[model samples]
Target: MDQNKPFVTEFLETYKRHPALWNAKSNVSKNKHLRNLGIEDLLKVCQEKFKDANTAFVKRKINNLRTVFRRELNKVLKSKTTGSSVNEIYIPTLWYYDLLSFTTEDESGRVGISSLDDDTELQFT
Candidate 1:
């Protein structure tokens, strides 16, 4: 853990090293028992380094991270269809944008992505 990095950045960096935390299409990521173990493993690291994290906090942070990443990805993906010029296209400015790219894959084997519209509800397992 680097002392100078922000907690979110460190969290994302640590999370990137664990595919079960982000790669939904993976078998390991799909198993509830394995996913909980992976989350617990991440919580341990956060507790050791940040000292203020708990299971609830870790879970919330993970959800928030994924939510934002999905939103940004959706923006970028949607921008391509709007026929915007290169300069007018939505470019993700989120620092963790690229780091969370693993989640951009369409795990359901669909050729197209449904929008993450404001009216749509996201179900977290």
Candidate 2:
């Protein structure tokens, strides 16, 4: 196995300059509402959704989750602190990004797109 040198500084360094470390395209979310929300909101939603999961055993499965979350969250904050204009949070490299785009079926079940560009007028069909 190769040693992952990415986090040598515990990710204390800004990742914006690193292409492999910071690719915004990786974090596309299909749930536009959820995608628009920041990380804190996302966590709150997750907490609420899993509120009833109070089993100690099950919770223990995520023993190191908080630390990992904290580290990742801190990295995001740092990124913003350094003047990153990227309003939407993208996933880390080599990770899956939730698709934010929505598709619809036309009269013949053919897929249709809302709009691909920034021009909002074209999105309305």
Candidate 3:
């Protein structure tokens, strides 16, 4: 069995759920085509397509996907744990870029902001 099968399955499912991730037509056939690429290529495409889409909704969706990815990754790690020869884990760098681009903190640490919209003011929480 392919080791990355679970990760690939989860990624394709998530990719299909978001119409914004589609390259051209947002349809099942097109999405299947998109899923043919490797994980790294998929992340690169998503990063390029949604780079400037920094609205609150988009950010929230991306963050949600990140959370899902992390959870799935944990499952993978748990399954692969052994004496001392586990394979090194790897994720696309663009995934981090997409999630972290809107995050920022100041020295005061009072204000937490993660939206790119100009009208959406950063509030202290």
lDDT of each: 0.77, 0.35, 0.46
TM-scores across all candidates?
0.69, 0.24, 0.25
lDDT of 3: 0.46
Evaluated against the true structure, the overall lDDT of model 1 is 0.77
Cα displacement (angstroms), candidate 1, residue 66, comes to: 1.5
lDDT per residue, candidate 2, 15-55, as tens digits? Answer: 22222222333334344443333333333433444565343
Cα displacement (angstroms), candidate 2, residue 66, comes to: 3.4
Q: Candidate 1: misplaced stretches above 4 Å?
A: 1-5, 106-125
lDDT of 1 by residue, 1-125 (tens): 24535666767777776677677677778778877777787798789766888888888988988898889878987998899889888989887788777666636365766678879888999
Stronger candidate by TM-score (1 vs 3) = 1
Pick the winner on TM-score between candidates 1 and 2.
1
Ranking by TM-score: 1, 3, 2
